[model samples]
Target: MAFDSSDLKPVGARPPLLDYLVSLWGARHFVIYDARVRLAVSQDHTVLGKVWLVLNPILFGFTFYLIFGLLLQTNRGIENFTGFIIIGFMMFFYTTRSFVAGARSIANGQNLIRGFSFPRAALPLAINVRQALSQLYVLAAMFALVLVVPPSERVGLHWLLVIPIFLLQTVFNWGLGMLFAPLVHKIPDVGNIMAVVTRLWMYSSGLFYEPSRFTDNATILALFHLNPLYQILQMTRGVMLYDTLPSMEQWSLLVVWAGGVWLLGLIAFWRNEESYANERR
Candidate 1:
């Protein structure tokens, strides 16, 4: 009276990649529900509640405008510096927040990880989803600022491109979060260093000033061009502020970046799945 144990696997073992992906797909409903609940409660402790989502970006835009636009005169040649800075800060924060939150998701969710035997990637994925939901309010506030501020931009067909650009950026953000979650889970200190790194990234992405104004070096310029966030802000500005369509080249680069990072990050995160639950202890 022996049982066939060949098909039996240990609990908490990592599944095959394809099976892992399928399991994740099957858990989409849980992910969405978790994201929704997190988004709803994210600001509950504050008096301003969800208003902070919109107000935070508005404040960031104002601070940058004051420092760079009014004081430093970085807005010198740009026609609509107000709109440019708003788009840059609002859009860039979406990715930055996602990256930081995702990087810390594993460490913060140790309790849940210990309690459940689910795909480890779900924590970071849920963080990205919550950020995406929050970005909707940020986007509304951004559009309002660009429309009402002096030198207002007109709405055009090109503006519709924001939807796709945002979607691509979300995917990129998810990938970045997944890429760093494991590292942060292991070292913990990488999370501390990310603040400075992201600040440098913000500057390099040309959030407050035009990169071309300061650098004439072809290599530096090309590096900026290759930066996905740079391309995202550029394309967003092109459509939202300039009423121009992003070139095919810009679109291609973004697609490559988003897809490549997503694939790479998935592998990175999934490879260490079994270790996540154990390491957290």
Candidate 2:
């Protein structure tokens, strides 16, 4: 596992791993520049540019509203279906994009893989950072939308829970991305398969309907609570809708799951790091 100096094969003025890490840290400007350009390119070429950030979750919220709010009438007991859906969808999208987009990052960066010798992992990390920042735009729109359409209960101090929740979600996203990195790199079709899986995941995560609304059976309730996404969403709903903190059990589960997933993904991705630069799609 050691990078022996004698064993190294230099590429251009390629720095040592430690030096690369240090330089990468100092290259904050490069990271920011790359992030800004990618964000702009991804946004500008589209019809609405940055507004699409707002539009995506809004569109999803309205669609869920029609299905769960009206058709199924799943808004029972709890109030403010719109706020509920908005928070849930926006947060869930973070995980979904991480899963789908992160899955393809290596293959997508094929050119960089062939051309550059810096941390191959940075490419994926950069994508994750870019997407995370994009989520803030959606968060802002969520606040504005909720203000105009005011939820039944006031947004309380518990809304601040979003800070930690997002941090946990980001780590979880990184883990998911790393875990999938090699899979997509090898099979390619796994990326397409993940897209379908994530859609199914959204339906099951109570993005459209609250899991609690479905049933009271112990087995069914247990199943819903066990879903990590459900656990995270439950924590979010407790904060935003009820203005209450999650139970200690919920917080514990979030920490355990996020930590476990992240470690697993990091190890999985690192194991194959040496192959990434040479792999052909």
Candidate 3:
């Protein structure tokens, strides 16, 4: 068995950034198709099926309303606490699901990764889309419920701002998903750690209360503004509660982090695409 010198060729330099992005852009069709297919199968055999999306958030909202709005008396002077909590819970949960679900994407889909040859990022993209779609039903139902509930606010086009906010949040979620895939694949315990961290994130994100209430200390107030999750929740709150545009500063931070994470995740994930199918814990 003799090895030939020509057969020992070196790998070429990585593809240019523009070229890589173009390839991803061209692969959008596959991403959409996969997203739809996975979305369909997500509730294939379930009894409640898609209704779970609507039901789950309402249930959680009730729990929060009971504990925070009623029992704990944490509402302070905020108006329409129920509707406020509902919006925050639904929107934040969407991203939480995408992050936690995507953590296992590479490890659990060994067969697909091994058998097929497509953009690996598509798996997380599909997961993100499916989760977002599932959660959208919750968003609609929550707004509708607010119409009937005694303390609920009336619907208006101002809430339409949710459209752009959600779209941008989706980009941020996908970026995170991209980053988590490889790290979780390498460290299986990252799954448990992420769950705990997301719980802390949920509490700290001020989904249940207004961050504006925290003005006791300069550092604390500044910390709330700098928190990315707080910024996102603020954006959602602006559209759903105040019917106003998000602050320029908040939007700028979200854009930077979203774009930076997306690029870093793309390069990181692509670097591991060829090995994903074979590597395991």
Candidate number with greatest lDDT: 1
Every candidate's CA RMSD = 1.1, 4.0, 3.2
The number of clashing residue pairs in model 3 is 0
Stretches of candidate 3 exceeding 4 Å from the true structure: 1-19, 212-215
Please report the candidate that would top TM-score against the real structure.
Answer: 1
lDDT of 3 at 127: 81
Q: In every candidate, how many clashes are there? A: 0, 0, 0
The sequence of per-residue lDDT tens digits that candidate 2 reaches over residues 193-236 is 88789888888888767666667788877877777888788788
Pairing residues by index, what is the TM-score of model 1? Answer: 0.97
Q: Report the C-alpha displacement of residue 51, candidate 1, in angstroms.
A: 0.7
Residue-wise C-alpha lDDT for candidate 1, range 235-275, written one tens digit per residue:
99989998779999999999999999999899999998877
TM-score of candidate 2 relative to the true fold:
0.88
Question: TM-score of predicted model 3?
Answer: 0.88
Candidate number that wins on TM-score, 1 or 3: 1
At residue 254, candidate 2 shows an lDDT of 84
